[model samples]
Target: MQQITGREAAVAVLNDPRFVVPPVPPGASGIAWLRATVGRFSSGPAHDRRRALAVAVLDAVPPATLRTGGGHPVTVLARALGIAEPVMDLVRDVAQAYQPGTGDESRADAAVDRLVTILGGRHDEPTAALIGVLTQACDATATLIERARHRPVDEVLHADPPVRATRRQAQVATTVGRVTVQAGEVVLVGLAGGPAFGAGPRRCPGWDHALALVAGALARDSPSVHEGTPDTAPGTGRD
Candidate 1:
């Protein structure tokens, strides 16, 4: 395993074709199924397809311009995804196990089951795409809000990002920032002080949506200003 810290090194690793996201276990159902099926854990053509699915899901769902009385980011995202009942707890449960080897799989699996039933059992990749958008936005948006309380959202993202490190596997032995990473080695790419939204093709596709959510949320939490505008103003090229 290699821990890459330099900004150039992280960018190189992220942008390089030789490095890919660590693959999640496949051939199983529930959380395993979700991980295996989602773009986050895939590469090559499959990754492109899955990523397009996720992007299409986000394309229809509009980010909230302001944090309303009942505006939780998760609920906002869920409703935008066309889920009549955006069960926060279920989303939270699944998000707990969204990442590989992180949360209680059994609980998350059950949550996925229930959530699926709510979605009318559409087990196709679009369903996975919807689920992925909601779960990914849940915890990540919340953390960004918390971290930005005493700082600007952009500054916080740069100085103290919620996702500090991301893992990549070297597909071939390659030199990254003067360090030689062996094939199949896990490279921990540090995002701190690096590109906040990442660079290259596999970079996160929801950063603009994320910023809108965070900006709205933080504005609501402010003592003097309860209502805030979205990240993009009226003239700011939203379309």
Candidate 2:
């Protein structure tokens, strides 16, 4: 709602620390969208449009801004920036629900709500893929939630990667690492830098955001769990 120029707003957002992730090592795929959007607003149309674009971009693929690789310095800087990864997962859930092949309207709608709560703003194409990843995790979590609707999660576990992920569609693809599954909640890890699944603090903030977001989703969708009932139901159990 603040009426700042796009260039100014983008610069401000980039510097906000809530968005920008720590820079990863070379040979890693940085967020192309974030770099381009920032470049565009760096010098483009009027300030209002730039501001709107800035807002849209932030609302869209905010996860791109989260720092993933580097070291404690980056993590420390990223956290100081308020640029944690779990928040991005909330954006992702809503984006994925809208995907064409997902085939679950309820899930999509729920994702949209989750996105709204997380971003508290609009959406765009740039953020769509990230959202899709969130949605996938939501779907997988939903699957687990449904299976263990009456159970409690005693422990959180993670599974090592059995195979590498292939790149093709606009989904979160991993090559190295493992998959995380806890009480039917499953996610990919160790791809690129950080399992890229939103687990640890030093890895891809995108995945971290996704994991936190899905955990919330699972709680909401299952009243029993939300109400403090134990999740004793059997689940995937991979961390």
C-alpha lDDT values of all predictions: 0.71, 0.30
Off by over 4 Å in 1: 64-69, 222-239
The estimated TM-scores of all candidates read 0.87, 0.25
Please write out the lDDT profile of model 2 over residues 1-239, one tens digit for every residue: 11112223323322322322322122111122222222121222432343343344335444433333222222322343354555433333332322223334454455454543344343443333333333333333333334343343211212222111111111222221122212222221122121222222112223343333334434445242122212222211111
Instruction: Please report how far candidate 1 places residue 208 from its true position, in Å.
Output: 0.7
Top-lDDT candidate index: 1
* Candidate 1, 1-239: lDDT as tens digits: 56888788888888888888877777455778877787877889998999999999887856553244236677767766667885778877887777666668899998887877787786667777777877777766667777788787778777777676778889888887778989899877777685666768877788878888777777677432212312211110000
RMSD of candidates 1 onward, in order: 6.7, 17.4
Candidate 2 residue spans exceeding 4 A from truth: 1-100, 104-137, 141-157, 160-204, 210-239
